[model samples]
Target: MSQNTLFDKVWDLHKVADLPGGSSQLFIGLHLIHEVTSPQAFGALKDKNLNVKFPSRTIATVDHIVPTDNQSRPFKDTLAEQMIDTLEKNCKKHKIKFFNIGSGSQGIVHVVAPELGLTQPGMTIACGDSHTSTHGAFGSIAFGIGTSQVRDVLASQTLAMNKLKVRQIWCKNRLSEGVFAKDLVLHIINKLGVKAGVGYAYEFSGPAIDLLSMEERMTICNMSIEGGARCGYVNPDQITFKYIQERQFAPKNENWARAVEWWQSLASEKDAKYDDVVLIDASQVEPTVTWGITPGQSIGVSQKIPELKELSIDDQFIAGEAYEYMGLSPGQAIKNTPIDVCFIGSCTNGRISDLRVAAEIIQNHKVSPNVKAFVVPGSEKVAKAAIEEGLDKIFKEAGFQWREPGCSMCLAMNPDKLTGNQVSASSSNRNFKGRQGSPSGRTLLMSPAMVAAAAIEGKVSDVREFLKK
Candidate 1:
């Protein structure tokens, strides 16, 4: 067990009681709900004839099922429409705040919360969505819960869970231009293996993490689940306070100063103890992309696909699977692997900063004649910010469609889905089979800017080649 680390401090501070099953009943300070996962939990409450015990602590938003392109009354997809309606009705019934479609606050739950100041430093946030760890970037403890656990939070505002060991992932050195936090995380995942964090919480610290903006930190922590970590977080600092200071839901004036002090206290002490530690050099990290099904199967932009026989026996089998599914030959460079679609949105990297970075790559460079590319902001606020900065026009002029805000092609619950066996260069998280709403659709995960670079070349091109030095 770790001592004096942020994870230890936050867990102990919010622990309600020790449960009988070798787990602690942890208090959740913020509960974020989306359309897809909340319906059944709401139904469970209805079955019990119960109401949300702490409505103020929970916030509702429609994301997973909402259409990014055509969000009109009654979504074309029957199931999606039903989910929206269920969330709306449930939020109203429980007197919980709901950010519905067309509501400026509505977007992906993870994206909406931080931008709106709802996710604050030193808070413990939970959501039913796997990427709820996204909120951990604010130096908070965030967890992803199952539907039943969702019901638990709604009823009692607490979750029972065994405490996790802490892993200190220290990254020093500075990243090169065009090497964003997405690439940094992918680099870490590839080195550490996806399951390395199965029983641990990751504390992302050191110079590299310290340099990232709050949005970048969110992008890194957002996919901690993909790395098999229960949660991932950065210690609060000036950047954290600056991002939260003027947000809609954050503390103000004296409360603001008090909050910052408390947030500072949550950081691991200089001599903090940890169960494990891993060190990474950011300068050595490259612009990375997922070559196979898992986030751990990533490689550098300049690297070639590994031959099955060259890998460990277990990974050799995975390589074989990827070779068959991705239709790529071993030893072939991932560069120039053709793509048919380019999707740029998800809880992981769909914020305005991501858009701005991708837009720079998309500027003056047109999408390939055969490639279909589009940009979807993670939240209405992000969308508004992009538009204000004229990124929408830049994308449109570069032969990309600028869509409305929602989860978009990240999960493809909406109309923005990949067709048939067509492959994609996506900035979103998850490249699992059928994850993009097409049974045969293939996805290659990369940074938003890398997706932009590929969109222009119609292939897995190196973004560093296109970026200004």
Candidate 2:
């Protein structure tokens, strides 16, 4: 058990009561829903004839199955169209706010809410998507719920859960250029193992984390679920407040100052005790890429693949599976592995800052003829911001397609998918088998900048090489 940490504070604040079986009834302040997961939950509600308990606390959006390339009415995928329609109808029936397609706020649920200032510190947030932990960057407690849990929240605005032990991941030093928040998170996953945080909530703190922007913090916390943590968060600070202030849904004027004060108070006490702690030196972290199926099976871009004997027996088994699936031999360098497609978008890394960083690498360069590359903004706001800064043109001139906003290629529920056996340099999270639509497609997860460098070179080239140019 952790004491005096932000996780403890936030959890205790929102705890409605202690239930039987040692679980707590936790109140959720924000409920984010998307087309893919909400339809069934809404259907369950219809079956039970229960209206949304707190419609104003819930927000809806269409993202998962919407095509980034062509978002015209009546999506070509009949099922996708139906899901979107169902979400729209349900939102209307419940009178919940929905950020539908073409709405200026429409995008990935994770991406849309934060930019709108809907995710605030000390609140408990829940979404039906695995990456709902993305909202935890605001020093909030967020969890990804199953469909039944979605129904539960819609009916009662609360969830039953056991408390999580807290792990303080203290990062020191500063990241060098060409290395990024994505690379740092990959490094953490690789070192700690994917399941290390299984029964814990991760508190990412210290100099390295403090220096990161709110978006970077989001990227780190976004993948906490992949690391097997229930959630991850950073203590709210000036960076968090600055990012939230003036956003569409943020408190204004006197209330704004009071909100900041309360958020500041939620920070962990100096003498907080954690169940576990791990320290990482950011200076040692390099531009990283996932070489195998799981995010934990990653290595620095310039590093060689691990030999079976170099890994623990359990890791050896997983590595063997990876070697067979990825078709790469032991000791093969991750660098220079040829790639066919490059995708740069997702809730994980599709913010305006991510686009700017990728655009910086894509500028004055051309995508390799052998590679097909594209950029999808996380939200309509991000897309509009990039266009204002001319990042879209930079991408287009670099031989990359600039697509409309949605969760494009992240899960490949849409038209933007990898062809058979194509290896991808992706900025999005996850590299699971068949994750990018094609059963045989391979995905190599990397930072948006690294994806841009790979797109230019048509291989797993070192992004540092481009940064030095």
- Residue pair clashes in candidate 2: none
lDDT per residue, candidate 2, 186-270, as tens digits? Answer: 9999999989989899999999999999999999999998899979999999999999999999999999989999999999999
lDDT by residue (tens digit), candidate 1, 167-202: 999999989887989999988988888888898889
Candidate 1 stretches with Cα past 4 Å from truth are none
Report the number of the highest-TM-score candidate.
2
Among residues 3 or more apart in sequence or in different chains, the pairs in candidate 1 whose N, CA or C atoms overlap within 3 Å are none
**Shift in Å, residue 102, candidate 2:** 1.1
Residue 135, model 2: Cα distance from true site in angstroms: 0.9
lDDT to native, each model: 0.89, 0.94
Off-target runs (Cα >4 Å) in candidate 2 are none
